[model samples]
Target: MDARQKQLCIGEGFHNIDYRILKSIVDCIYEAVCVIDENGIVIVWNKGAEKLYNIAYKDIIGENIEDIFPDAIVNNVRKTGVSVENKYHSPRENSYILANSMPLYIEKVFKGAVSTDRDFAELIKLYFELENANSKLIFLENEVKKISGVFGNIIGKSPNIVKKIDMARQIAPTHASVMITGESGTGKEVFARGIHELSGRKGLFVPVNCSAIPSELFESEFFGYCAGAFTGANKKGKMGIFELADEGTIFLDEIGDMPLHMQAKLLRVLQEREIVRLGGEKNIKLDLRVLAATNKCLQEMVRESKFREDLYYRLNVVEINLPSLRERKEDIPIFIDYFIKEFSTRNSKKIIGTQRDVLNILNEYKWPGNIRELMNVIEHIIVTNKNGMIQKNSIPEYILSQAKKSESFKEYPLDLTKAIKKLETENIKKALKISKNNKSKAAKLLNIPRGTLYHKIDEYKIKCPK
Candidate 1:
């Protein structure tokens, strides 16, 4: 064969093989794949890209990518010789995509750029669907609790909790102001809600987070405001929390956080049962009940002049203190069972129960965050649990470490006399070890007389290292 014929044959063979490989690999990918030349001209547009952009390869292959898709990531990659990974892009309206683009280099020179993109519309849709489902589940849970009773949400059968429940029921029907005090996350809000439900009021229950309202907006937020009251104010005016809770109950959470001036205003409103809207002269009479909760010592605040004594006296008509989890440890198992069922149903898990060991560890834990922390731990366990039961390893590592520390502490005596003796014994042994069994040096190290040290060693019967 002649030289020209041989060269033509080789060129045809190479073109056929390259075309086959490109069609099989790049064109078959599910994610959109596009390649551009050195001048931002489209060289390869896969079927995925065609489907995503709604433009065919024949129509776009030879076109400059800038004209077709001005903000294409491949164009930036070619111009800057820089790569972009997992970047958010919206090529068209309502089209969300996550794209990875890289500059293609051949022999240390920039050749072009290639990009792969995955549509995120489906993922976003699924996320919204999950959130909707969770909302429905929570609504159903609250409805179920309501059906049970007014105090159904507060889960405890301990003496303290039961006593508090009875007291709450006795006072719920009255119009007296109640002060619910407890440590944070000890179901103070739940108790307040129960009181409202039992009150048989015909108005809405408006919960006001005293700490969250800005000081500047306190008056307007607690009372109604007239239209055009201030710049950026709602044109139709707004009803403050107290006004909204007319003829019902207003739950003031974190009441201690109310500023001194606001406290005076609140006291006046409560005493008069009337509120005059901001920028208006007419006093609006209200029949709402007030229930305030705090995780602070209002008595101490009164002594320090941080809180108003008159307001304290008015709000504390009846004080009901909720017991902390540590104070009511016997109720831990009940809370665990309740939370397990709730979380299991939410997560679509069939978790029958936790292992006895897991329960033991959880019960031993001093839940500083109280019921809130326990609820979170149960949710975590339900989410991570694979089997039908919650195993020891499924518990959070932090809880396990804390439980271990508690167990170690439990080995020591709690009695004052015995604790002191035990601590003395351990220190004596440590001193002896540090002094290499020399009694005189050990006594000096312990800062105790040698005679006393000898008496301690004999009393405690501590063995010395030979």
Candidate 2:
């Protein structure tokens, strides 16, 4: 047989063979592949190569690889008779690819080289998807830790609540100041304590309600007074909260209620990391983490000039916004079960559960006071019922009334499309607000790609207020 016939010949197992059939199999491969002779001339170019490089096999065959795909490894391997493995190369603009090239030797004589390429962009896209999935899993794990008694034994499994718990867990180990924002009964203090506990701080966790501390006494309460500092001051002298919180965490609840003058002093303390007692002359340095919580809108307060912008920015380095009980209604049942078991165990009652009607009523009513209100109602039931399951008539009068009103009230048509759009818009706005106008974080919060978020923003014409 001639040399051409020998190259086309199949092994002894095959009786009849066609070169076209072999070429067809090679062309069907997904990875770009190429073969070159010892002189660096293209001898075989598969269909994958044509699609990847946007050049036909007929155009590249018999031509020098250097003229077209100049960076092809086939040329290098042909020259040195050495194989190149897993090399990254970009043959065209925006075309990133990984390739493997090996020299072909027959009977100890150099012949040519074969190279295959895989699209790098596709691999990168898949990697990003995997990372996003891992982030979600971490969020769920952190939420599970919270309700299972790892941190303050929190209870709730709604997506928004879980996301906030996850964020707190991520930032707890750091010394960065955190701001917790939510309505009055949303358990901001609980979230703050959770952060402090997970922070692994050695010092004690001291909590102070800014609204309760009189403006005139703010300085004395925050910083301390020395002996004989004032007429009514303690004779032995008092250490300020900042001092008491050394090497620990001091939770500043209702921070937005701090007076303007006190805000200035607080900003100074944050910047200098030191404080002077009410009557002392010497400055006391502090090493502690500050976790602030508020039921009011700090940004609005900043704009209204009620809160100092500098102080707000300082304490707002890391913010965890808790969702209200009404917003995360899915967690109502969980909370109901948790609070029942808690109150029952504590009160020495054998209350097993609540009736279905009672749960429906509780879930339907908007919890204006959030979890605090929910706990109070549960305790009321446990105390009043004392035994057996809680019934509809046993619930609070206000909750039953609210549930009746909610059921009777009517809104626009319950079209699924419109409802979905409204929900989407509300979620987007919430994410943007929580992220402080950071589009990237908002996208993560919404569990969508950044590009998709941008598209939704445009479609909904959502305004980001920061």
Which candidate ranks first by lDDT, i.e. highest? 1
Question: What lDDT does each candidate get?
Answer: 0.86, 0.82
- Model 1 misplacement above 4 A: 1-142, 147-149, 412-466
**What are the clashing pairs of model 1?**
none
Candidate 1 displacement at residue 65 in angstroms: 64
Count of clashing residue pairs in every prediction: 0, 0
Candidate 2 lDDT tens digits, 136-189: 565556567664433546788789988988898899999999999999899888
Error of 1 at 252 (Å): 0.5
The weakest ten consecutive residues by lDDT in model 1 span 6-15
Per-residue lDDT of model 1, residues 1-466, tens digit only: 3445433433432334465467578877999998876778676788998888888877776667899788888899999988999999987677789899998875676768999998888666776578657756885977788644489888888999999999999999999999999999899988888999998998877788899989998999989798988888889998888889998899999999999999999999988999998888889999999999999999999999999999999999999999999999999999998888777767766665668999999998889999999999999999998877789998899999998888878878889899889889888888989999999999999998999999999999999966
C-alpha RMSD of each candidate structure in angstroms: 14.7, 24.8
Task: For each candidate, give its TM-score against the true structure.
Answer: 0.61, 0.56
- How close to the true structure is residue 88 of candidate 1, measured as C-alpha lDDT? 93
